[model samples]
Target: MPDQIADPSDLRGDCAQCFGLCCVALPFARSTDFALDKPAGKPCPNLRGDHRCGIHADLREKGFTGCTVYDCFGAGQKVSQVTFGGQDWRTGTKEHARQMLDVFPVVRQLHELLWYLNEALGLSAARPVHADLRRALERTERLTRQTPQELAALDVAAHRQEVNVLLLRTSELARAGVAGKGGKGGKGGGKDRRGADLIGARLKGADLRGASLRGAYLIGADLTGADLRGADLIGADLRGADLTDADLTGAFFLTQPQLTAARGSAGTKLPESVTRPVHWTAGS
Candidate 1:
């Protein structure tokens, strides 16, 4: 099997092919992320008839920062087009709309796993488990294509657990040989900070090479100029975190959503997998 999937464009959200599912199917409470409360299955007031955000150009100015950070991992278009046969929720029956909404989240979760699996397969160091990752990816893609009823009835949590085991192994294999700056060998010399609560903590200029930061709460934390090469950032909450000038050159499992939610600058070196957030400043 090839080390990487042929194409990963399907793993990304494409709003043009979607039916505004995220705007309608997801709920949001009034907070710094959102400006108002919205119930599930209801359209956001900013949604236009064409299934585009009316405030797309000014989401941040309009107090919809959360909207800018969220990514459906291509689940929106899958549910909107493939699953529903291009059915528009606005024109569908209330029951149909509800079912679509319910299934959106389920497929979203699966697609997220697909994203991680795809990434894992691309890692040269993870070649030992590449075949398993490929199998998991194919299985996840099959699950995403299931009927809405099957999706709604799917035990996604159980599936996630199964996939996570492979991802954990992949992480171990990928990070095992990344020697830290201080001559520390093997997994960044014991910088295991998995699931740590570092909210609002100052970590500027810290060296976190090959560190395990999976499931860590880094909300509002200052990570400016940190050396994060080879770090595992799966499930890390980086909302409101400062990443100015941070060196994340070889970081793995750092999704676009997490990168977008944090603050950075043009000088912040990032891995090729994720793009630099537009909100990031031009200078360091």
Candidate 2:
């Protein structure tokens, strides 16, 4: 597989292809993430008759910032088009709507795995296990096509665990190539800040090659020009962080949501699964 994936980000989302599933299928409580309280199966008042959010253009200004941060990884369209045969819940039978709600989350998990698997395939250093990655990718894709009944009963956590093992191996192989070589990483290699509280830390230009930052709190950190190639950023909180020229060529499990929340520039090098936010070019 090539380092650059032509359309892997398509797995991210295309709301036009969906049936407003997120607005109706999921529940939200009043909190920092959500401004209103809504129960499951209840449609958001902002949802138009055509299934588009009426406040999409000014979601954050209207206190719907949570909507902007949410990504279903293309599950909405899969459930709306494929699983439900292009049916919209507003017009579908009550039982059909119920089934659609149940199946949507399952598809989301499957698509997320697909995103990670595609990214792992893009790591040239992990070429030795490309065959295994291909097989895992096929399995995940197949599961996404299962019927609603099958999905309702699927052990998605177990499936995710299996895929995670391969991803960890892929991350190790890719990060190893940039581990040592100098600076904060020293001669032995990169630093390990896994699950550390790095919020507001001054790590600008730090050598983080091959570092495990899984579950790290990096909110508001200054990481400009950092070398983060092949780092494990599975659950790192990047809201308000600066990555002006950081190199993240092979970082594992770094989602588009994380990047959109951070500050970066055209100089920032990213892996295949992430897309640079349009606002990043506004010279903030």
Candidate 3:
């Protein structure tokens, strides 16, 4: 195994080093999340000639809340600088631009896997599977470096399934140590809520310590003051969920985009992996 691990910073979005690929490659419908409809492969009207968002600072205020919460997991810079050799999409041919756009989403998925793998490797309780996590991380990193054609043809979903197995193991190993630690409702730790339909559920002040919330639909759920320490939150949809004062310290697999989509307050306790969303304290 390598002496040094991949820096977590490299797995985060750095729009300055990118050509605004997310602004061009992603599609959004005119809903509460977005101000207008946008088709895939088309540049967002707010994208400037220099590939920066014109209304970036006021995205939410402009009804483009979807844009504010979207994260490419550093795939934009990887695609722009490493994959395309820093080629500007605007200066390229139509076909060249299309190819870049096509490969962006694929690499984004791979990068996301890398993020999860990296986090898993950091868990001391998951040390037993650290070697497996490292190997998976390395493999995913290599895939992100593949050519545009190769990436476009890659079966990312299949690869993600493979990585998820190791992540699930890591979660079990880590959460095992916290088992039996009851939450606010006095529910036992390590709750199995995987893929649960928690949408609009009244879970305020609920105890969810060491819970497996993978792929759970938490849209518009009331999670205010909920205890979620050491929970596995991978793939959980937190869109419009209220998390005011929620105690999520030590939560694993919780990504920034998920936190950004939820409503929180300064009183909300969070894990070190994700920062508190600026919008959470905007008016306070």
lDDT of each: 0.89, 0.82, 0.88
By lDDT, who's the top model here?
1
Q: Higher lDDT: candidate 1 or 2?
A: 1
Model 3 lDDT-worst window of ten = 180-189
TM-score attained by model 2: 0.89
Residues 174-266 of candidate 1 have per-residue lDDT tens digits of 888664654544443337788999999899998888888899999999999998898899999999899999999989999999999999998
For candidate 3, the TM-score is: 0.94
Cα misplacement distance, residue 181 of candidate 2 (Å): 7.1
Off by over 4 Å in 3: 1-4, 180-189, 282-284
Stretches > 4 Å off in candidate 2: 2-10, 180-189
Per-candidate Cα RMSD to the true structure, in Å, reads 1.9, 2.9, 2.8
Q: Candidate 2: deviation at residue 1, Å?
A: 3.2
Candidate 2 lowest-lDDT run of ten: 180-189
Q: lDDT per residue, candidate 2, 34-86, as tens digits? A: 78999988999999999999989988788776788789988898888988889
Q: lDDT ranking from best to worst?
A: 1, 3, 2
Q: What are the TM-scores, per candidate, against the unseen true structure? A: 0.95, 0.89, 0.94
- Among residues 3 or more apart in sequence or in different chains, the pairs in candidate 2 whose N, CA or C atoms overlap within 3 Å are none
Ranking by TM-score: 1, 3, 2
